[model samples]
Target: MQTSSQLKRLGLFDARVPRYTSYPTAPHFKPGIGAELLPDWIRAIPENEAVSLYVHIPFCRRLCWFCACRTQGTATAEPVAAYLDSLKQELATIKGLLAPGIKIEHLHWGGGTPTLLQPDMITDLTHSILNAVPLADAAQFSVEIDPSEIDEARLDALAAAGMNRASIGVQDFDPMIQEVIGRPQSYEITKQAVDGLRARGINSLNMDILYGLPHQNTARIIDSVEKLISLGPDRVALFGYAHVPWVARRQTLIPTEALPSAEERLGLYYTARDLFLAAGYDEIGIDHFALPSDGLAKAHKAGTMKRNFQGYTEDVSKVMIGVGASSIARYPQGYAQNEPATSKYQAAARDGRLAGAKGHVFTDEDIARGRVIEELLCYFRVDFSKLADELSRPIEYFFTMVDGLELAMPGTTDLSGTVLSIRPEARPVARMIARHFDDYEMNESGHSQAV
Candidate 1:
């Protein structure tokens, strides 16, 4: 394996760009598309097709300094209780828009820490969701948990409420790194959390890890990985630390000088990727990995893996409905984000509103480019010919776009037949390739590192 410095010397990691979690990333979302458009989009969903849902819980017991999510730190239950009330109301509002008796294929809870919600509150929310939108027989209900916030009772309650998957946030187990990030969790506590969840019949598990933190280095990260992998999570999401102190104020607490260099970050990523693969895990997308038997790995093998607001998934729905504050709902037409502030969200729901804040409506061309980007990002190859065939167009028409990318990446871009692929060596430039399809205006206001 090449060292970080060696890769840097070769200029492998240079650019800063969006992760393409969404083609027109969240920053591009303006307040243009709102409540008036939602009903029409919701009504357009095919009655027979099942969709996925993501619920955002924005509260955390302790705010990790390196965290960038839209979350609040709370020491009491009053705010959470109020938030739950708004969430239930939001669910009801969404239910009213969907066709009667809609079937859901997957439900996920993500947050500062979903476990911050009291056990009873978790049950209440789950019941409200099931009551409104009927779940498919094989629907997968999952949640992101903070090991520190959960007890066996809470675990049991979650299982009873139909949660089959649990993702524990274990960014790094190194004591020094944990202290710097302000999210300290012992290996024992995380193991117990997983054991408790499994004991309650919730078997699917994902452990999230982070690299390129303020004090993180190859040795420290490997130590964390070794500890986490021993606990045997079925999946792992290895994310590079996005140091954006400009946006998230708390990030300033991290000593920028201590942060790893760009080249070092690349090495950290490759090192982690090599470690996971050596452990018998198959890389799913850019950052996710799963054991061969895991649904994500199987999805990749079957060429059915999907990328969405929640990162890579097996949920192949064209639409994703987000509930709760800071949630985002994706329709074929566009994406809409709910208000991020808890009080604002609650107030809107209480006023009998959708809490729709700002979002972008995709043009027909935007949708076409989005599909091309999605196919290339998730599968690493896009059959422009096949896509052109679907649109009843000729491949020659898209040759101009290919010419543009070839100019940007030179030898890195390859075209054989009607299929386009980014060379394996240019995998880190995947976002650059995807950007060819992004018709949205590009600016500093809307993106993270391309790597």
Candidate 2:
């Protein structure tokens, strides 16, 4: 009760903050960092080094009301087929710019449903990507598989193309909640997908479940979590439902009154969290859990874990190239996002130009602050002395930014000898604490609840 009081007093329930997936966050990304700079950025990649690739398939059979991702619903294969061609063109353009010997260490296909692709389309897309930059030995190829859209033929194609890791989104298994959220994937369908993946020797799996959904209660979340546990995913991402109907207009279809209160939302998170821990899953940063043998767990234990647009990751590659519309690539120089509109992105790629539309070039201060934020979020602590050495700045360089953090968060953080740490009990407020280090202005309405 005292801890709950402290959390309430600290405004954890009321505050809305950026997820801090990126330091400046996407909303603050400005224009003018588009196509012109892409060639130079791609050329700067050193030969013989491994980089990550992210392919976005923005087409879905149906749009879920809770999602705010850049996606469109297409019932026909015509638009998808057309989009695939443009994606291939974009890959070819990237291939033209690459230096020899560059290899992909981590390849992820995220979506509106990468599984929406036909079996042949999957093989062809995989071939195009591999042809551009071959996968390095031991490279990890992961795809976001939609249970409702995938089947044996597609699984065979993915297996043949070397997809070793599969990520599935199981928001909740409850029928009522599924109906309310417009994502009608059932536990039976989800299990079928998992069974299919395992039968194909693709045992490495990542699953996502959500808390704070409309009509979610402790009993409801417990039931969903147990069902997810029965599926035995290698890694699980328990995310809080980010209800921003203003941003994701489709979310308006969900009744606002059905949503859990901020305090109830936090309770739901802890309820589900305790279940994962009790099941022998090692906590991986904020919302992720991994079996001890999973790469993510190893990364967390070894202190090499990183946070990106995809949330917690073990990939340490310095360069991550994103293909397809609305995809963002991270180069050492800065972050570049492709044209978000599929038509615009396709036109640019077909015309033999990169589709980069908006980005943020990292200033020195941006780098320092971004590292601080990343460290805080990933490890729940920032060692200023270590960062100073790594960044080649004096220890005092971070003092000004961190000054008064304790007061702002009020007993949630401990600053000792230039190192700042969020107490274990205060981890729920980590995003709010990270907000203090943000140099840019934030519109609270643009973010989700702090809890």
How much lDDT does each candidate structure score? 0.81, 0.89
**For candidate 2, lDDT tens digit of each residue in 1-451?**
2366677666565425678888688877778786868789999999998999999999999999989888999999999999999999999999999999999999999998999999999999999999999999999999999999999999999999999999999999999999999999999999999999999999999999999899999999999999999999999999888887778899999998999887788899999999999999998777899999999999998999999988999999999999999999999988899999999999998999999999989899999989999999899999999999999998888987776565566677888887889889889878788887887843353322232
User: Each model's TM-score, in the order given?
Assistant: 0.93, 0.96
Please count the clashing residue pairs in each candidate, in the order shown.
Answer: 0, 0
Give a tens-digit lDDT track for model 1, residues 1-451.
4344544543344424567778678888888586768768888887777988888989989999989888888999998998889888988887887886578899999997899877899889889988778789989999998888998778878888989998888888988878887888999998889889877888899989988877778898888888888988899998878887787898888888988888778878888888999999998767899999899999999988878888888988888888888899998889988888888889989987898888889876666677788888887888988878876666776665565565445555678888888777767667666776566643353322221
C-alpha positional error of residue 370 in candidate 1 after TM-score superposition, expressed in Å: 1.0
Task: Please list the residue runs of candidate 2 whose C-alpha ends up more than 4 Å from where it truly belongs after superposition.
Answer: 1-16, 442-451
**lDDT, model 2, position 9:** 60
What lDDT is reached at residue 401 by model 2?
78
